[model samples]
Target: MSRFQSKTLCRVGILAAMYVPLALFVGIQFGNVRLSFGSLPVVVGALLYGPLEAALVALVGELLKQLLTYGLTATTVLYLIPPMLRGLVIGAGAVWMWRRGKRLENCRTRCFAVCILAAVCTTIGNTLVNWLDSVLYGYYTFAYVFGDAVYRFGVGMLNAVVVATVAIPLVVLLRRQRVVQEVKRP
Candidate 1:
C-alpha cells in the first residue's frame, strides 16, 4: 500500500477501536431505538480522510464488536447496515461537497448539509432494516410496525441532531488542530 493508504488504514483501525466502547456503553437505547455515539468516529474519519476510511472503521469495527460480544447469528448481519450506511453516505457526501469547492473549513452551511444528508440516509436505511427484520421474524403486524416506525423516526431525528451538532464542530476543530488532513482528488 502507498503511504497515504497506510496512514488512512492506521487511522481507521484506531477509530474502530474507539467506536466499540462508545457504541455499547456511551450510546443510549430506548426499546428498539438507539442513539449511538459510536458513529461520531466514523463521521470524523470520513470527513477527514474519505469514504474508504469511514467504511473500514464502521464495517470492520462493528463486525468485530458483534463477533466479540454476541457471537455469530443470522441477526448479526442486520446490525452492519446502519453504521455502514452512515459512514458511506456521510463520507461520500462530505468528500463530494469538498471536492466541489463547498469546503467545510469556511462553510457552515455545507457542513450542515453533509450532516443532514448523512442523518437522513442513516435514519431511513436503519428504519427500513429494522422493519424488515421485524417482518422476517414475524415479530409484529404491519400496524404495529407502523407504530414502531413512528417511534424509530423520532429517535432518528434525535440522532440526526446529535450527529450534526457534534460532528460539525469536531470536524472544524480537527482541521484547526491539523489532526484532519484534506485528501487531494485525482
Candidate 2:
C-alpha cells in the first residue's frame, strides 16, 4: 500500500478500536436521554475516511458492544441495524457538508453545517429504527412509535449538537498540531 493508504488504514483501525468502548458506555447509559455522544466517531470517521468506513466502524462497534453485554440477542441484532444505518446517514451527511464547506472556502461554516446535518440525520435515523423495533415487537402502534420517535430525535439532536461542538474544536486542535495530517501522510 502507499504511505497514505497505510496511514489512513491505521487511523481507521485506531478509531474503530476507540469507538467500541465509547459506544458501549454510551449505549449502557442511554435511557431518558434520547441521544448520546457515541455517534461522534461515526461522524468523524465518515468525514475523514468516507461513508463505508464509518458504517463499518459503527457495525463493528455495535456488535462488540452486544457481545460484551449479553452475547447477542435476536432483539439486539435487530436493533443494531437501524443504528448502523443511522451512522451511515450521519457519516454521509458530514462528508457532504465537509466537502461543500471546502468548496465554499468556509471551514468553520462547513463544520457547523456538518454538525447540524449530523444531528438531524441521527435524530431521524434513530426515530425510524426505534419505530421499526416497536413495530416488530408488537408493543406499540406506528403512531406511538412516531411520538417516541420525536422524543428520540430531540435527544439525538441534542447529543449531536454537544458532540459536534466538542469534536470540531478538538479536531481543529488536532489539525493544528498536525496529528491528523501526520496520520494521513505517514
Candidate 3:
C-alpha cells in the first residue's frame, strides 16, 4: 500500500513537472502550423492514476506555463479547459474500461479508442474557447472559428496518436517494473 501511494505521488510530480517544460519548449512549427505534445503527460497521468490526479496535473502544469509564458492573460485560464477535459475523458474512459473487463485483453485497442475520443472532445472544447476569446477580444467571425476547425481536429488526432504511442509502452513498462499496481480479479 505504501509502495502504491509513493509511486502515485512520484508519478504525479514527474508528470506535472514534465508538462510545463514540454509546453514551454517543445513544439512542432512549420510555417503557420504548430503542434504541441503537452497533452502527452496529461493523458498518461489520467490513464495511470485517475481523474482527480489527472486534473491536478493539467492544472499545475498549464497554470505554470501560463504564468511563465503569457503572464496571466484573460484567456490564460480559459485555455486550460481543453487539456483538463482531455484528461477527464481519458480517466473516465479508463474507469469504463475497468468496469467492462477484468483482464482487458484488448487494452491496446481500447486505449487507442479512448485517446481518439478524448482528442475529439478536446478539439471541440478548444474551438469553443478560441471563439469565445476572439469574441471577447473583438476578433470574432465565422471564419475565425470554423475556418480552421478541421485543421485543429487533425492536430488533436495527431497529438492523440503520439500520446497513445508513447503512453502505452511506458505504462506497460511501469506495470512490468511493478511501479504501478495492476490488480486483477479472479
Candidate 4:
C-alpha cells in the first residue's frame, strides 16, 4: 500500500476502535436518546479523509457495537445505517467544501452546518431503522417509534453540535501536527 493509504487505514482503525467505547460507555443519556460523543471520531474522519473511509469507520464501529451489545440479532445490520449516514453526509460535505477552496478547519460555520445536516439525516435514518426493528422484533409499538423520533431528533442535533465543536479543533490540531493530511476530494 502507498504511504497515504496505510496511514489512512491506520487512522481509520484507531478511530473505529475509539468509537465503540465512546458509543457504549461515554454517552450522555437524554431519556431514550443516548446522546454520545461517539460521533466525534467519525466526523473527524469525514472532515480529514473522505466519505468512503469515514463510512468504513462508522460501519465497522457500529457493527462491533451491535456484536458486543446485542450479540448479532436480526436488526444488527439495520442498526448500522444511521452512523454510516452521518459519516457519508459529513464526508460529502467536506468534499464539497474542499472543491470550493474552503477547508473544514477554516469554515467553522459551514462545517457546523454540514455536521447539523448529517445529524438530521442520521436521526431520520435511525427513526426509520427503529420503526423497522420494532416491526421485525415487536420490541415496541409503531406509534411509540414516531413519537420518540422528535425527541431523538432534538438530542441528535445537539450531539451534532457538540461533535462539530469538538471535531473542528481536533481536525485543526491533526492537520497542524501532520497526523492527518488535508484531503481534496475529486
Native-vs-model 3 lDDT? Answer: 0.78
Highest TM-score, which number? Answer: 4
Clashes of 1: 0
Worst ten in a row by lDDT for model 1: 103-112
lDDT of 2 by residue, 1-186 (tens): 998777766766777677776665654334555345566776666655566777777777767766887786556765566546655665566556555544111265655565566566655665666666676777867666675565666666666667667666666666678766622210
Supply candidate 4's per-residue lDDT for 164.
90
TM-score list, all predictions = 0.84, 0.72, 0.85, 0.93
lDDT of 4 by residue, 57-165 (tens): 9998999989998897888999899999999999998888888877865799888898999999999998888888888877778668898777788888899998898
Residue 35, candidate 3: alpha-carbon lDDT: 71
Runs off by more than 4 Å, candidate 3: 1-11, 30-33, 101-106, 181-186
- Judging by TM-score, tell me the better candidate of 2 and 3: 3
TM-score of 4: 0.93
Each candidate: what lDDT?
0.76, 0.62, 0.78, 0.87
- For model 3, residues 59-147, the per-residue Cα lDDT tens digits are 87888887887797889889888789888988887767767663221388878888889899988988898899999999999987878
> For each predicted model, how many residue pairs clash, with residues at least 3 apart or on different chains?
0, 0, 0, 0
Candidate 3, residue 93: Cα displacement in angstroms equals: 0.9
Model 3 worst lDDT window (10 residues)? 97-106
Candidate 2 TM-score, C-alpha based: 0.72
Could you arrange the candidates by lDDT from highest to lowest?
4, 3, 1, 2
